[model samples]
Target: MIEVYTDGAANGDPGPSGAGIFIKKGKNNYHYAYPLGILSNHEAEFFAVIQALELCRKEFPEEILSFRSDSKLVVDVIEKGFTKNQKFLPLLQKIQEEAAHFSFFFIKWIPEKQNFHADKLSKKAIHLNKS
Candidate 1:
């Protein structure tokens, strides 16, 4: 199965932000980072998941996906039928809708400390976006 782990960071809740994702399949692994213009941290988290799904669709079209994220809001909305806060409801719904395009997909919640790689990249992404 193709595996993906993602995370996002913001200097402040409504500050400059970024996202990072790590994708792996067997021995192959790849990482991506993106600058997010001013936005909330939660939005960045949502964006990371969106970006990961898009990349997975493009690069691993034939494989099943097992996705993981450290954000509870993201994982719960996607996997557990948790209703998002109204502010996030549309975004969550949109992500869920897009995920349906995948042949197979699953999401699991992970603690922030266990998501080191993604955290590192997201921090780097913040720095990169600054310059």
Candidate 2:
């Protein structure tokens, strides 16, 4: 199974943001980052998971995906079947629908320190997108 780790970072509540993803299979490592505009940290966190899944769909299709993230919102929403914020219901539903295309999917929450690599990538993404 391939393990994919994702995280998001923001400078403030509604500030410069980014999404980071790192995928590991065997000894191979893959990393990606995408800049996000002004939004709540929670929104960026959800975007990170979506971005990670999209990457997997394109690059690692048909493979077993074991996804991990430092965001409690991302992990709990998908894994524990917790209720999502009402504002995000539509997006949450869309993401869930798209995920059906995957052969396998799993999400876990990890400690913040363990997610530093992705955190750095996310911060870099925000910098790259600065105008």
Candidate 3:
């Protein structure tokens, strides 16, 4: 099983945003930072998960994925497989599509303190937008 920790951050609401993903497979670790132009915090959070799943599809296909995120909205929306917010519908669809590539996919909400690695990466990504 592969463990994935994801986080997203924006300087302001609908401001420059980024997605960070930290992956652990056996004794190896991987990190990814995606600068997402401009998006809301919630949108960025969703994007982080999407990015992580996409990476898994290419690097760890057919592997069981256990995802952790500090965003409750993203986790709940993904677990329920539904969302009334129009902004998230397309994002959710993309997640579903990417998730299908894996045999097993799971997402859980974790405390911010427990997601330090991804959190730091996301903050770093936000700075990337300036450079």
Error of 2 at 39 (Å): 1.2
Question: Considering summed lDDT, which 10 consecutive residues are worst modelled in model 3?
Answer: 53-62
- Compose the digit string of candidate 3's lDDT tens values, residues 6-120: 9999989989999999999999999999898898999889999988988899889978999999999999999999999999999999999999887899999999999989998
| TM agreement with the true structure for every prediction | 0.91, 0.92, 0.97
Those runs of model 3 whose alpha carbons end farther than 4 Å from true positions after fitting are none
Find the candidate with the highest lDDT and give its number. Answer: 3
Clashing pairs in 2: none
lDDT of 2: 0.82
Clashes of each: 0, 0, 0
What are the lDDT scores of the predictions, listed in order? Answer: 0.84, 0.82, 0.93
Tell me the tens digit of each residue's lDDT in model 1 across 1-131: 88899998899888989989988889988888888878799988988888888787788877788888999888877776557388677777777876888888888998988788888888788888878
Off by over 4 Å in 2: 82-84
Residue-level lDDT tens digits of model 2 in 7-88: 8888799898999888899999988989988867888888888888888888888889888888887787877554647856
